[model samples]
Target: MQIRVSIFLKEKIQNPNGHFVLQTSGPVPYGFEVPGLIRYFNAKGQEVRRTRFPSGGNYTSALRQGSFDLSGDRVTILGTNMYNTPSSQEMDPSTTSNSTRKQKQADTTPNPLATEELNLLAKLMGGMEVQKILNVDAGFKVNLLALEQEEEGM
Candidate 1:
């Protein structure tokens, strides 16, 4: 079986309801800083696989999708979007280096989201077998298999 995941970044704004909300004004040109660990586990609650190395997942506009292969009746994928961590991974000076240090800067900018605060979404899937395909287009991006760059041909 095949699985796919897509991610995007949006800004949070208050809609005059005194509540903070995420809004997508239009197309975002920059890649999102999604550095962290991506793990795939089968129905038994054991790690079936994970990225060979931690990901420098700077989600780009490219195809906006990550694909993989798996076979199972059920699977639970845990995407640990590591942000504000104590140590930094091999990252490009452009993608996320500055995004984290700044506060939610402005409503016009799409800031990193700490899910515990609210909504959650990042395509994840796990099963007996996994092979990541990080087909990219213009900027930095990765899939479940992304270690450094992406396999555009995959």
Candidate 2:
């Protein structure tokens, strides 16, 4: 069955102005290679990003993390040991340094996940977590529930 996942940008974490929301459609199998996830900005045009599972890389340790970059717009998505960790933070443009720039280049390199981060992420992926589910209808109810169940199993 086909599925659609709503990737809501937190209110405080808006994408570059004029960019549309990222509503991913299709069955994203576990360890799926999310390629060229694009977001458009009025000022810069289009930006591209890669979203892939990082479970086998440095993230194999305690947590998993993934990375992505929206170069032209200066936006990056970094996560813990897991590719799509529960918590995310944006780099402040006001602060620039060698290490910071290096990290930006790395884009979505999985970062070491702390104990708390891992646990929180797990909970979020689990039913114990609460999220604002968007864009649901009778057709997708079953698929979404299955998706949630599948995610919790992970």
Candidate 3:
């Protein structure tokens, strides 16, 4: 079964191990299981990574403790919602309770990368030439634009 979920990174905490702790938020469809598996995709819809929340627990809190090595900033997470109605009493109440509480807490935390920063990072990582153009002080904007036009012409 296909389940549509809107996943957004709530906060990113830098860990001592150089990996990041990503706190994400999204609505799990009614009857969806908690601590479910989430597969992250890039903008191209390519599956980049996958993670599972600890069993028998709320994912919002568990996600805070999970570590990930994400190279890009934008991601789309996909997961299946097994049921249309809640059958497990434990899953219903805890999911709602934890989501509500975490929502508030996540809002107060700052996002690791702003939109513009993310865009720049994506561009810099596009290719070695893009990185070189961004680093050079001489007409970098014009050079980047020209490179884009060249790519489109190909």
The order of the candidates by lDDT, greatest first, is 3, 2, 1
Q: Write the per-residue lDDT of candidate 1 for residues 1-154, one digit (tens) a residue.
A: 3222222212223334344444333223334434355779999999998775554343334224322322111111223233322233322222333354343233235334443122212333312122334742222222456443455555
Which regions of candidate 3 are displaced past 4 Å? Answer: 1-12, 22-33, 36-56, 60-141, 145-152
Put down candidate 3 lDDT per residue, 11-126, tens digits, no spaces.
Answer: 22344444555544554334455656798999999999989765553344322321132311111222222333324542343343545535544655645555446556655765
Estimated TM-score for each candidate: 0.15, 0.18, 0.20
Candidate 2 on 1-154: residue-level lDDT in tens? 3233334344323354535544344323335444433344555665554344433222211112222344322322223223244233334332434575566557765455553465566566653443334843211111235466686786
Higher-lDDT candidate among 1 and 3?
3
The C-alpha lDDT values of all candidates are 0.35, 0.40, 0.43
Best by TM-score, which number?
Answer: 3
* Candidates 1 and 2, the one with greater lDDT: 2
The candidates, ranked best first by TM-score, are: 3, 2, 1
| lDDT top scorer | 3
